[model samples]
Target: MASEDLKEDQEVSFCLNLFTLRCGHSFCRVCINQVLNTKEGSGVYSCPECRAEFKEWPSLQRNVTLCNAMENFISNNPQQEEITGISCTYCVHSPIPAIISCLLCESSLHNNHLRVHSEEAKHVLTDPSSSIENRKCSIHKELLMYYCTEDAACLCMSCTLAEEHWGHQVEILDEAIERKKEKLSDVLRKLYMQRQKTEERVQRLEECRGRAHQKANREAERLNALFTDIRNQLDDLEKRMHCEISRQEEQESLSISDLIQKLELKKDELSRNIRSIEDLCNMPDPLTILQEPDMGDLCDPEEGEGEEVTGYVDDPEQEEADEDSKGDTGGDYGFQQILHTLSNIISDVNVVFYGQRPADILLDVNTAANNILISDDLKTATRTDKKQNRPETAESFQCFQVMSKERFTSGRHYWDVEIAESGICWVGVCYPSIDRRGWQSYIGSTNKSWSLFIGRGYRNQCSVSHNKSELMLPYQIFSAGVRIYVDYEAGQLSFYELCDPIRHLYTFTTTFTEPLHAAFCVWNKYVKV
Candidate 1:
């Protein structure tokens, strides 16, 4: 009997049985079939769990025994039974089948029930004699006479007339139920639209999150690369710093050793010189042991006979000789020579004298020949006089010739002159004529024996003397000689050798102050003697 009951239970459980694989897994029949059909194989099936290969395997088949066993377990446990009660569909009271249908109200009930019931039980299945109606009214206990649409039921005449339902457009229960169902459908449609909007918002947020995650990953990679590069640079810098420091230390050590060697050599030389001087002072004179020499007689008593006398040589003679020898070698070595050499070296680096600059002169349009005027300041001379001199010729004078009626070119030119004898002299510029005749010249004092001349060519020439006595000429007749002078404010004088025939002569009156009286003559006919 137990075996039979088990078989029956198995059949019931199998109605909902599912298939499972040999891997100790289970699924529905449809799910297993899908996996098996899609798997690639011909002769053998591989165990999904152990991945073990097998040959000559049978096709996939359901396990009937297992299915039956599971179905049997299900069938043995049956559902529980439910208890039911009978009552009127519209009323609160229990109903009985003893009474027949009512003729006045169309209701059923058992006999011996109340002749009239409450309004709530008016629609129950009861006999007509027991149906609820007057006794007064079911609700208010008064007689029912009117029907009210607002109240949705039959009411007493007084209730209909009352304010509660006087003017309302209310309906019966059936109409109210229909109206509520329509409103519920509209609310459901609106709720479905709101749900769709919420789903769209969720999808957009997911996309944004994906993009943010990708950006963060890329930034992390970039930072990692930068860190690696910085580490490499720091390593290289450390290596270079070590090399530089080692090199500098080696150079400093070498320089210090060389300086120490030079100082030691100088100290040794000084020590040797001191020792030599001390030894010389301690030596004794060899002349101290010498004997006295004899001397012959001074006057002869007779032509043939003579007497001799001698005195000891003085000891001071040896000392005086020693002192004289020491004077040549003692004291500082090459002191004067060292001073001279140092002075020469310093002089080579110093600037002592500078050469003169040639004057720059231009033509003066106003000055006339022979009566030419000198510069007022005497620093500059102009051939022509104007109210305010032009800058090009303001600092120097311009030369002109009355015969040529022309001016000299703007440039430097040189000339020389000499005194016939030792005397005061003056040199100046001479404007030339068209026929090369001298028209004008300027003269000034040779304040000293020598002076300087500076200016542009024939335009202007300035002569300054260095000695007051040299300005007076000793001879009236003199010969031409070369006198070279710098034509600017530079202080220098040069004399030229003169070989022409001229002689000494005396002067009557000499004036170094004025140009007219300061002239030195050149002999025209014969050499003065």
Candidate 2:
């Protein structure tokens, strides 16, 4: 029981107002003061635990380390009223509260035990519960005071002298940690900025997608409405054709009905005459019969001729022939009617397609052939046998065909070319990308060209080299002026004879795959635009 009481008192010893003398022995400050007061005239003080004497009442310093240890110990074991005093971890000793901890040895020891432990182990010591023992090199059992910048770890002085860390740059641990923290902060700032930009890009893409979807929907609705209108027109045309046929049939039926009514009237008149003759022949008295109306006039053939009635019979063959002729004429009439309607439609479309639009007709001087001379107005071109002295350029056409400056990729256009009297030329349009040096550049010679020839006969050709299919116009049309019309949207190229009444000569139809340029080939003749 006495030993238990001593142990308990030792455990709570650090919690009191403690003081340490030069001999490194700790006791309560009040107890130390009482001892000092009793030895006032002795001119000397003594340590309670070590029994070491000091000269002139040795100065006692407060044990701050022991006070901190006591606070930590109490806080950690708050539920327990008393603590099992810490024992010396290095040597066998009775339980006592520890005041110092060895960092290298990782153990807590009392003052007496710490002196012996530090001498034998050469371990660094600190206040108990300070956790300095954890900051030691495991391999060398030394305090880690330096940080290896290359290895990015805390290291001891012994490690810096070893082969592994030799010549490696190092800094103090606190300074290294501060530099790493600054670098990490910069990285975090850059990451935040990148995230913001990515979010903005995602938002923009979403807006673009939404707009595209809306435009597509609007176009689809417009197309649907246009197709619906086309279908309605077709239906109306069908109804009109059927109604015209029904009207023709009704007119023919009325003619037949009139013929029947006339025949019936003639039949009734003849029957009345027959009944009159029978009554006169059946008279009982000869005098009464002779006296009965002009019997002599009836017997006289010449006089009766005027009284005789002849009923005309309808000719079945004649009726059939008439009907056959009407049927034969109806086919041609229907065909012409359809042609007329289509012509009207084309005329209406032309107004919309070519309404006061700018003319895309300009001569490119760079593309003129060496032997060709262009008028000052840039509207006429003429070829001569003598080659003009002009510098060679990429845009110059090696062949006779020179492309116009303006290129057409869409929309409609019309232009007229007046051929010089008795002069021949080729006028039309060609793709700008066609070979300018080879024979393929010639108008109507390659697939990229379509032209009307005003030479021997007015003929139009398309890719004549591959397939020679040319359409000849009338002689009158050749003598007259020529007009070229293009509906690029519909892929139509039409030539017309500019006579009193314009006559369509020929038309070339194909989907234009590239921008087109009006090309002219003046073969030893002048052609005006």
Candidate 3:
């Protein structure tokens, strides 16, 4: 029983030495010394367990009963605390009534107040010089006394007197602090609004990116489809080109085969003709052997002469026939007959010559309508017939005649006459003036003698003849004449003679409707006559 009591006492004694020096609580000397030395120059020696710091070491008066009790209690209950009251360092009269104490002033205070005392009272509040030095004026070196509302800062008394802050209302520090707080609140509200706008812009950009991706995907798909179509078209084109080439090759091959076949057939026919000619040359010539007589056999017929001694003198006709037979022998009858037959065939074939043919003319005897009027300038040698109802202006004229058999039989015919004055002549062939090839001429001849001959055909060749007679007269008579020719067949025109066969001459005539000078404005311009 005594040993058990002694062990209990030993346990309590071990715990009592574990308090810290900073908090006036017993602890291991080594543990307290490590904490005190870590913060040696800070004037704060803190307890490791309770974080209680002291400026100086407390009196080491050991409380025997309490320390033993605490030691036993801590050993049994490891988390127990000692509820000790502390005194305030700043107000010595007030009891701190807390577990911690201020290390700097060596006065007891609350655990929380111990930290505040060093920062606010011991270091900053106790040093009046540092406090005044830290409160520097923001604008000037003078000590700040007032705050400017407009400048949003503390200003020295001298700065407040400046002209820049003349109209601005000055305030104390308390009031400036309140205003700055309100302004900060406003700035925070604006920042929130700007944040919302930025968020909206980001959302729009995200949507735009999504749309761009979709469009790019669609374009890629379309391009792929187009490429596929192009490939298909190219394939089809290749097939068509290949087919065309094959067809051309087949046609060319067929043409070559046909040409080869024709050549082979021609070669076979030539070979057969050559063999037949060789066979004909090999045959013997009977005429050649018959012409040669056996004269030796006739002289050696001694035995045969006795048997038939009726030999008489050869006839001159027989000798002459023998001589003639010798001369006619070896003649080539087949070759001569072949040559003669070939020559006859060639001679019998007709040969044609190519050139022009003679000309022939045809004339149509037709009358004009009664309504048309003839011109007045026309010359009339004799008025065989007259119409009472004809217009006096003579705008048109028509005449018709049937030729006799003698006139038709004439090979070539022409008319020669001289015009007394300038006039227009309307020539016609086959039909009336409507059918003639028309011509206009300015007459320059007085008593001009002209000759018109039958051309290659029956067509009349009209020209402006200005040749005048050399005979001089008192009155100048513009005599221009034209000749008319008749052709039974239509023919081409020639200068003076017939052209060739196949050409025919045709009959033609001319009539004057009006005076040439009046109808063609000949009076405006004069020609040498």
RMSD of 3: 47.8
RMSD of each: 42.5, 29.7, 47.8
Q: Write the per-residue lDDT of candidate 2 for residues 1-529, one digit (tens) a residue.
A: 8545544765643434566778888877567768767875665667767778866546556676876566555556443212434455655645666776777777877777755564653465665643654678889878887898888779988888888888889897668878988998899789757865664565466457646645665555654544454456557767887887687667656766776677677668667767887887888877877776664343444532322112222567865776577576655226556555555445433532223543747788888988888878888788887887777687788856577888888887887777766666778888877777877667787888888877623242212121234555544434446777778988888776554334455667688899888889887567777
Which pairs, if any, clash in model 2?
A: none
* Candidates by TM-score, descending order: 2, 3, 1
Which wins on lDDT, candidate 2 or candidate 3? 2
lDDT of 3 at 397: 28
Candidate 2 Cα outliers beyond 4 Å, as residue runs? 1-145, 256-529
Winner by lDDT: 2
Indicate the TM-score of model 2: 0.35
lDDT of 3 at 169: 83
lDDT of 3: 0.39
State in Å the error of residue 232, model 2: 3.2
Q: Model 1: how far is 373 from its true place, Å?
A: 80
* Residue-level error in angstroms, candidate 1, position 96: 21
Q: Which lDDT tens digits does candidate 1 get at residues 273-299?
A: 566545544557534323312212322
Query: How displaced is residue 486 in candidate 2, in Å?
Result: 10
Give per-residue CA lDDT, model 3, range 280-322, as digits (tens).
4565986654555543442343432322111111367865766
- Where does model 1 exceed 4 Å of error? 1-162, 172-175, 261-529
